[model samples]
Target: MRTIRVIGIGTGDPEQLTLQAVRALSEVDAVFVLDKGSEKADLVALRREICARHAKAGLRFVVAGDPERERRPADYAGTVEAWHAARASLLEALIADELGAGEVGAFLVWGDPALYDSTLRILERITARGRLAFACEVVPGISSVQVLAARHRIPLNRIGAPVHITTGRRLAAGLDPEADSTVVMLDADPRFDHLDPELTIYWGAYLGTRDEILRSGRLGTVGPEIRRVRAEARARHGWIMDTYLLRKPGAE
Candidate 1:
């Protein structure tokens, strides 16, 4: 029997790691962290920092290189599917080498595994390989949304208002068009430019660490501001995770 622990390590701050996530880290024999090579070394380092600060037991870490994401719509889903398969195969090999028969492996996910993350799904694909029957568990961590909300002291939704969480891709396509409040993530593109500038905006970058930046104003006004800040932040950090909340008036 093989078991893999899928643990969310939160955005960047070690303080953001949940107690349960810490417990899960202590129990795993090896922690697999994705190193997107030199450009985003900070991401892998964040997991290491958390483990050093909170891991009760000494554990091993394996830094796996992440495959580049497929951006074109024509091949996006299929490309992601293929990427998962490849990642699973690579991870399975590492798991097999470490654990001959029964062993536990942990993956330190950057964000909550349940939200916009695909590690759990890829782990499932690995289990279906039948080489080793695998069971998996998740340890949730603080997400960018929580960080953004808390930083701004704003409720995601007020009373009867609805909050829709979506990707930058969908927002660029005009969002649901009917959502009162929308939270956009994974947005490399400046999607706010496409929307009606009347929408109020709250944008956050590098959301939970020392270098975190939070800015907001009317959409039209801040879009350019965020674009400028976003580029500088990304250049400084080498990587960034940002989320924004936009609402057309009458949303709440």
Candidate 2:
């Protein structure tokens, strides 16, 4: 039987690769990479760099075009399901063609695979189909959330209070006013503006890289700046991955 190791390569920094991840990379016969097009070519380049540094000699790469996802579909859940199905089909084909029995293959995921990434879910779908025969092992890596907290020099939770982690859409709908601290990820819009103006925000972009940007202040005063900076960064890089922490005053 073949094995697929889903290794988290951390954020943009090549040094974020864990020792275990390096071992996994060295053992893999092939690494499966998803090409997100030229707009995000830098991302693909980073993955290539990781393979170049850690993968064993003669290791091959199976690059597959990522399935396009609907940005604003009315049926968001249905659209995502369809997209995952398509990705599963693509991965299944790649594994069957590229991986031989007893050989190891890997997918270098950004951040922890158990986080927001869909690689593990897609792989589960492929396994459920029973057409592919491969065992999977996940090696956790530092997530952007951890990096954000570390860079900001703040704890994610407030004392014994719980921390709520959510996305922009959920944030726009609204968050619990009494909630201790809320961490927002995948927010392309300024949803934080709707929250309490007195709330504090710690924002970071392009984390773990030379282009990193950080901002922290009262939401009312810093919210607009975050929106502006985030927009300019996106325009400059053609892509951006940002996460922010919103905390109520005196919560800590």
Candidate 3:
């Protein structure tokens, strides 16, 4: 039987790799990396750097070109389903062609595998097809949410209050009043400006790395500045990973 380890390598810092992740890296016969294109070359480099830092010698590295997806299709759910199917097909082929019986392979995830990442989903699809036979193991890593909160020196939730974690799209629809604190991720839009000016925001981008940027203040005072800074950073780096926490006044 073949074995595949889905390991989380943390947000960005190489040192964030847990000892379990390090041991998993050492045992892998091959490491698979998805190339997202030249625009995000830094992302690919980070994965390679992690492998170089932790994996045992004589490790084989496989680089696969990621399938492009429609960014703004009319049917977002359908488009994502199709894209995932394509990715699963590609992964299935890679496993069959590259991994022999009893060999160990791995894919390093950017954050916790159970988070916003689709690698685990794709792997499940491949295994469910019954064409490839592999046992999978997961090793959790530090997530960007944890890193963001830690860097800001804040708790995710107020005392006995609930924290709502949602995407930028859902946030644009409406803010939940019951959620004392809301954490936003995958925010391509500046929806924070829609909230009351009295609300406070703590934001971070390119977290756990040298290029990290952080900002905090009342929404009215710092929202525009965050937007401007975010635009400049995206233009400079070709891509950005950011998250933020918002708190209503008197939320405790």
lDDT of 1 at 64: 65
Q: Rate the local accuracy (lDDT) of all candidates.
A: 0.81, 0.90, 0.90
lDDT comparing candidate 3 with the true structure: 0.90
Clash count for each candidate, listed in order shown: 0, 0, 0
TM-scores of the candidates are: 0.93, 0.97, 0.97
Model 1, span 1-252: residue lDDT tens: 777888888888887888898778777777777677787777777777877876656577777677666766587778888888888888777777765456678888877889999888887887787775767898888888888889998888877767899888777678676578899998886756668898888899887888889999888888898999999988887777899998887644
| Cα distance off (Å), candidate 1, residue 148 | 0.8
Please state the error at residue 96 of candidate 1 in Å.
Answer: 1.1
Please list all clashing residue pairs in model 1, or write none if there are none: none
Query: Better model by TM-score, 1 or 2?
Result: 2
Residue-wise lDDT of candidate 3 within 1-252, one digit each (tens)? 999999998889999999999999989988888899998889889988988888888888888899999877889899999999999999899988888899999999987998889999999999899888999999998999999999999888889888999888789877898888898988886756568899899999999999999999999999999999999999999999999998988855
Q: Evaluate model 1: give its lDDT.
A: 0.81
Could you give candidate 2's per-residue lDDT for residues 1-252 as a string of tens digits? Answer: 999999999888999999999988899999999999988988889888999999899999888899999888899899999999999999999999999999999999998998899999999999999998899999998899999999999889977897898888778888876578988888767666567899899999999989999999999999999999999999999999999998888846
